[model samples]
Each structure stands twice: as structure tokens, then as C-alpha cells.
Target: MKTIEKNVGKKNIVLLVLPQVQLLDIAGPCDVFTSATRFLANDQAGYNVFIVSGTSDKILYSSSGMSLPCSHTIYDIDFPIDTLLVGGTEPGVLHEINSDLYTYLRHIVKETRRIGSVCIGAFALAKAGLLKGKQVTTHWKYADLLQKSYPELEVNINPFFIKDQKIYTSGGVSSGIDLALALVEEDFGTFLASEIARHLVLHLKRPGLQSQYGNALPDYDMMSSFTKEIRDLLKDKLGQAISVEYMADSMHMSVRNFSRVFVRESGMTPGKFLEKMRLDQAKNLLEYTDMGIEMIAGKCGLGSVVSLRRLFLKHLSVSPAQYRKTFKRAD
Candidate 1:
């Protein structure tokens, strides 16, 4: 083990891609680092990106159906590393964590500058003993399983990602992009990193812990059949006139009882839940489309641009126009 006191000049970075890696997980960081390189004065040769695997020639497939070519096997790379990114594969895709590979990772950890994982990649690091006794995070779906496997892991379930010293871990699919942007900010400064975020059309940043409480990925079956029915109706008629009384009648219950059951079951008032859902959709629309705010508001059940701006101010801390402008830049 040696101390990384000498700042290694823009050096080689090995990205270890795996079988059934999630598309966004690998693409997110690649976009960030590649974009960051172009903006740096160091001629963008700072990073030597290599797709490494256990068997060098194996076709690395992602869950999104993209097949990436492997340039070298783990055993083939002899050069020292600056960053070693361990990518995630589907849960059952690669059951065998090669002992030799594990040993190799442990050896390299001492020399590595920073280690990173997107989503479930934390699992590989944990298995390698690199994450033991360290604060880390993974996609919430696997948070319990990872903790149960290694109680020594101080798993933070609330953040989209967590970093303890040189090792960093990110939450599920989309959070990988956020994690990559943060990495860019660290390496090339916020100015260029924000530029990459703009080119990628990603929100400049999102508080890592914000999405955990939104209840988006929670099982919808947690709601009863009737409750689901009403919710589905709301999704369908987002622009339709909706009220507590109307919602109650739609579910064939009295307004008072419906409100009580909705709150009891979902942990939020029905109106609040619908508002969150609408705002979430509106946020996506604002980022991904060229539609006017008024149009997005109409589609998201918020009625008008005014209502959408008010929601953005309270929840996202930016106006709809501003978010779009900041994220849609070319440079």
C-alpha cells in the first residue's frame, strides 16, 4: 500500500465493464469524463478509457441490449491506475465473482486514485472487501440485501450516492448520471462539468436524497385494487377537472372515508400524491421536450405555466424556463 501524494497527471483510467451492465450506468460516466476531457487544456488525452472484463474478448452486454467490445481482460492490464470503475451487472447475470479477479481488485485498491461504482456496482466492491467498514450507497432496491450481506458496511439508504474517501457509489439507473456529473466537477471544475450536464440534457444537479422520499419506485400494489383504479384514472385524466369529491365518487366511497383510506394507505393525502406525481411528470417534460411551460402544465395537470412555476419554486428551486435553459446549452 502506498500513499497517492503525487497528483498523477491526466493519466490512464480503466473502466471495468461487466456482463448485463445497465446502459445508463456505463454511459453516464463515459459521457461525463469524455466531455470533461475536451474542455480541459490537457488536450483531452487525460483519460485512456478501456473496457475490461474477466475474459478479455467476451462481449459485454448491457440490460438495454447494447453490446460493448472488451479491449482487455482484467489479467491483461499491467499499467497502474488512476480510477478503477467497477460496473454493475444484473443480479443473476454473473453469479461467479472470480476469486482471481477479487484478489486483483484488492491489490489494485492500494494504488488506485479513486474507485467508483454505479448502482449495483457497489456489490462487486463489497464482495472484494474494499467497501468493508466504509460508508456507501447503492440502488435502494438492493440496500437491504447489501447491508444484510455485510453489516460492517455503513450503508446510507437515503442518498442517491455516497462517498467515503476514494470509493464512491451511486443509487439506481438515473442517479448514475448525477454521480458522473459530480465526478466531472471534481476533475475538471464545475464550469466544464456543468457544460457536460448541459450537453447531456441532464438537470445540473439533484439533491441525492430528494428522490428517495418521492415514493416513485415503491410497489404500486401497496395500494388496493380500487385505489389503483383511481390512481390510473388520475394518470389518464391529468388535464381533466379533478377534486377530492370527484375522486371519492370515482372510487365509490364517501369523500371523508376515501381521504382517510388514501392517506392511511399511501402515507400522503390523495391530493398531495397526485400533485407530486404531476410535478414529477412536468419536471421530466420540462427537461426532455421543447414544449412551452404552459403546455407542460396542461399535460401534467397543473393547469397553467403559473402553477408550474410555483411548484418548481417550492420543490425544485428553479423556474421551468431556467431549468430548461441551463440544461439545453450546446457548449
Candidate 2:
């Protein structure tokens, strides 16, 4: 492998984009690096971002029907990449993994400081054998497929972004911005990153562990009739003190059988599903209503503020107050 010499002053951040790319996956991160330059003392301490086409073409069409002009092809990149991020394409493009692209990625991995993927871009990295045995994530919709495709990799769908060693993978579209902000924080400091985030009009520079607010509901069509019935019952009586035994009796089954069937149908234990429901309700109330923590807790059937805070901390790594402050919708 031929080594590319690192740039002396500004770190060169390269984004590798393929055809039918998601525009935000490229634009969001590029904006973060570009915006960071404004706050820096000089150009020497900033980032220089470049867009490289994964294919031979210099022009790539985005998933949104926007045409993107690439400055360089993958073969044209001879300079050292401080960070290399792969932007995702539409699902149809993901099926055809380019062998040449994979080879280029493998070669470049030796010269890059850190590598990352935005959304389904993890598929590219995985195809190149870059994510072997690494804990990573992608857009929630494709997390299951990615897991099945690469059994060696730990595909966690919950986090907005995750960094394992030098590789970073982010969830859906806007999560690329979060990943870039974190990268900026790592390269410079929290103060600079926070300033950039503020300039971007971001309410909060959410941590990597923060959950992605994707589709939270289980697949109703796939659930058994009994499971669907229990789901509806739980939804209607979320604020009531409902027990597993009660649910079991209502369904005319023993607790053990009910638990087993629920797990098989819902893909989570009955207790876990109930907790998730309560948490989802609590989150909605926190985001949309001007309610007190205790009131919100009671409304969500969490019973007390302590339980609510504990649940938030355990799942979101943020307190109820903090979550409210960050996500509260403008009235």
C-alpha cells in the first residue's frame, strides 16, 4: 500500500459519495466542517473538506433528484485524508456492491486517520470488510438487514451515532450532522463544537448515546391476534397499573405462556414492551406539553419523577429536564 502524506496544517476531510446519494448525508457533515472554519483563529487550524465520487463519473445524481458535481474521483485522491466519510445512497444502489470501490476503500483505510459512514453508507464499509467485528450502526430502517448481512458486526439501531475505536457510524439523514459535530468536538474542543452547533441552529449537541427518534411501533401486521389484542389493551390503559399476570388472565393464558408468546410475537418481553410504551408516552408529553416532570411521569404511568428520571437516564443518557429543554416544541 502506497502511503499518502498528511497535509501539514488543515486536516483534509473527504466525503465519498456514490450515485443516488442522499444529499443531507454529504451536505450536513460538510457544513459542520465548513462552519467550524469561521470560529477558528486561522485556516491552519481548520478543516478542508473534499467531495470524491465513488464511481468514475464526476457528476452524481442524488436520491432527491439533485445533481451533485464532484471535485475528484476516488482514484484522484492522493492526499492524506484526516477523516473519510461514506455517504449513503438509495436502497436499490446498495444491492450492487462495487468491487473496485471496495478495493479503493481498503487501500485508503491504511492512509486515513479515521473512517465513518452516514446512514446506509455502513453497507459500503461492511462490503469492503472494514467493519469486521466492529460495533456500528446505520439508519434504523436498515439495521436489521445490516445485522443479517454481517453477523460479525454488532449492529445497534438505537443510538444517533456510535464510535468504535476510529470508525463512526450514524443513524438516518440528520444524524450525519450529529456525527460531524462530535468529530469537531474531538478535533478541537467542546466549546468550538458547541458554538458551531449553535450557529447551525441546533437546539442541542446531542451525545452519541442519544436514541434516534425513528419508527418506534412494532409491526402490527406481523403480530399474532393475541399480541395485537394485548397491544391495543396496553395502549388504551397505559396510565393504569397493569400487571403481566392481569394481562395473562385477560388473555386466558398462564403467565409463562403469555410471556413466551408475547416475546415471540412482539420481539420483546411483555414487561419491556410496557416500559417502552410508558417511555414513549413520557417523551411525547415532554416534547409537546408544558407539564411538570411529576405530572408527566404520572400521566405516562411511571408513577414518580424519580422513576421517570431513572428511565430517561438509563435509556437516553439524559435527564427528564434536559430532554424537555432540548426537544420541547415551540408553542
Candidate 3:
């Protein structure tokens, strides 16, 4: 692998394309990286990006109709590279990467300054022995498979991203932005990162180590129809005071029995669930809307800014004002 370095612009960024690459996984980060470099370049738009794949260096069409032209083939490029980024799929396009792809990966891992993968791309890196004994992450859907296939690699899907020595890996699709932001922050500073995020309209620069389970709740599909009804009712009545007993009556059950079953299915008591819902809403409002803290409190069912603050601080570990100040989308 050969690398190219300019005086101040982005070093070479190589994205390996494979069959069945998820459109968003590849495109989303490409957008962010290009956006970040443009902002950093100010007037130059300095990144020299290339999309390469296992096959010919033609237009690598994604699962979606969008096609990104490959600047060159992996075999042809032998420049000093800053980074090699791989995109992932639900199940990757290749069952096993050809010896050529694997060899190219090994060559770069030994030569490149930093190596990383997005989503199931981590699967390929592990397959090529690029992530051996490295702390890594991938989309949650593939966590089980990754662990089973590459026990030598330390896999952590909970984080937005993970870095082990020279190898970096991130969770599902959009998370690549988070990892890229972290990289920009490392290479430049908080100001550059914040500006890039502003142009990209990313609200928060959530740490790569931040738990993906920060507020994980059961999926809508996991809920029974009755639970869905209850969940819907809660959302609708979020601005009002609601009680478990009231919910029980509406659902045609005794309060004690209803509470018992709700907790069992939701993994949280009624009060806790309600609090989470309100706080989640409050968080969104704080991040994206200009509603006053007091107004947001009322709209999200916390009733008062004081209660909202307490809950946000308790669970999210940030004050509403501080959170808004930091995470408010810029552009």
C-alpha cells in the first residue's frame, strides 16, 4: 500500500467497496468526511477520496441506485495512506474475501497510519486478520457473529466506535459520522470538530465510548398490541399527569395486576417508563428546538424545569441548558 500526504489537506482516505454494501453505511460517512474536510480546508475542500472494491475500479453501485465511481483499484494504489476505511452490509457481499482483497488489507494494516471499518466492515477486517487482538465494534446485529468468528478480537458493539492500536471500528451506519468526528477532533481540535458537525448538522459529538444502550428500551415491534396501545396513550398524554391506576383502568385491569405485567414486559416500572419517555422527549427538544427549558419541561410532561433538570442530570448526566448549549445543531 502506498500513501500520499499533502502539506495541510486530508491524507489519502481509501474506502473499500464490496458487494452488498449498505448504502447509508458507505454514503453517510463519506458525506461527513467530505464535509469535514471542506470545512477544515475553508476554501479548498481538501480531501482526496477514492472508492475502491474487490473487483474492477468502475462505478460501484450500492444496494440503492446511487453509484460512486472508484478513483483506482486497491491493487493499483501503492501510496502512503492516512487511513483505510471499509464499509459493511447486513451480511457482507463476499462470504470470504478473495486472497487479493485479504492481501491488500494486510499490506495496508502494516503500512497505513490508521485503519478502520464501519458497521459490518469490521467483519471483513477480522476476516482478513486486520483486527486480531484489537478492541473493535460493529453494528449490533452482527455482534454475535463477529464474536463467534473472531474470538481473538475484542468486540464491543455497545460503543459508537472502538480503537485498538491502529485498528478502529464503529457501530451501525450513521455511527461512522461519530467516529469521523472523533478523528477530526483528534487531528484538529474541538473547534474544527464542532464546525464540521455544524455544517453536517450533527447535534452531539457523542464519545465513541458512549454506551449505545444509554436509553435502550424495547422496540415497538416487541410490544404486544396492548402494550403498543399503552405506549401510544402515554405518548399522547405526555403533557398531562398520568398514573398507573388510570392506565390500568383504561386497559381493563386491576392496578396491581396491570403494573406487574407492564413492568415484566417493559423491563421498567410504570413510573420509570414514563420518566424515560418524558426525558427522551425533553432531550430531543433540548437538542433540536428553541423552546424554552420551562416550555420544554411542560411539553415533555416533567411539568417544571426543575424536574426536567433533575432527571436529565440524573440519567443523561448533563443539565438541560448545558446539553442544549453543546448539542444544539449549528447548521
Order the candidate numbers by TM-score, best to worst: 2, 1, 3
lDDT of each: 0.73, 0.83, 0.74
Which candidate leads the pack in lDDT?
2
* Model 3, span 1-331: residue lDDT tens: 3222223655677877876777777677677668767665544434566777766556666777677677777778866788788888545465644667777788788888888988888877887888778888887656645776677877766678888877889887788888877776666666766777887788546643333233333446655676678889888788998999999998899999999988666655888878877876777787778989999999988878899889876765668898788777765
TM-score of 2: 0.69
Q: How far does residue 320 in candidate 3 sit from its true spot (Å)?
A: 20
**Tens digit per residue, CA lDDT, model 2, 37-107:** 76775746788899999988889889899998989998787788889999998655866746789999898
For residues 64-102, what per-residue lDDT tens digits would candidate 1 score against the true structure? 888988778887887778887877876555466567767
> Where does model 3 exceed 4 Å of error?
1-9, 42-46, 207-331
- Compute the lDDT for candidate 1: 0.73
**Deviation in Å, model 2, residue 253 alpha carbon:** 7.9
Which residue segments of model 2 deviate by more than 4 Å? Answer: 1-12, 34-48, 73-82, 90-93, 96-107, 137-161, 181-209, 212-233, 241-267, 289-299, 319-322
The alpha-carbon deviation from the true structure for residue 253 of candidate 3, after best TM-score superposition, in angstroms, is: 40
- At residue 242, candidate 2 shows an lDDT of 89
Alpha-carbon shift of residue 201 in model 1 (angstroms): 1.7
User: Between candidates 2 and 3, which one is better according to TM-score?
Assistant: 2
Clashing pairs in 1: none
Global lDDT for candidate 3?
0.74
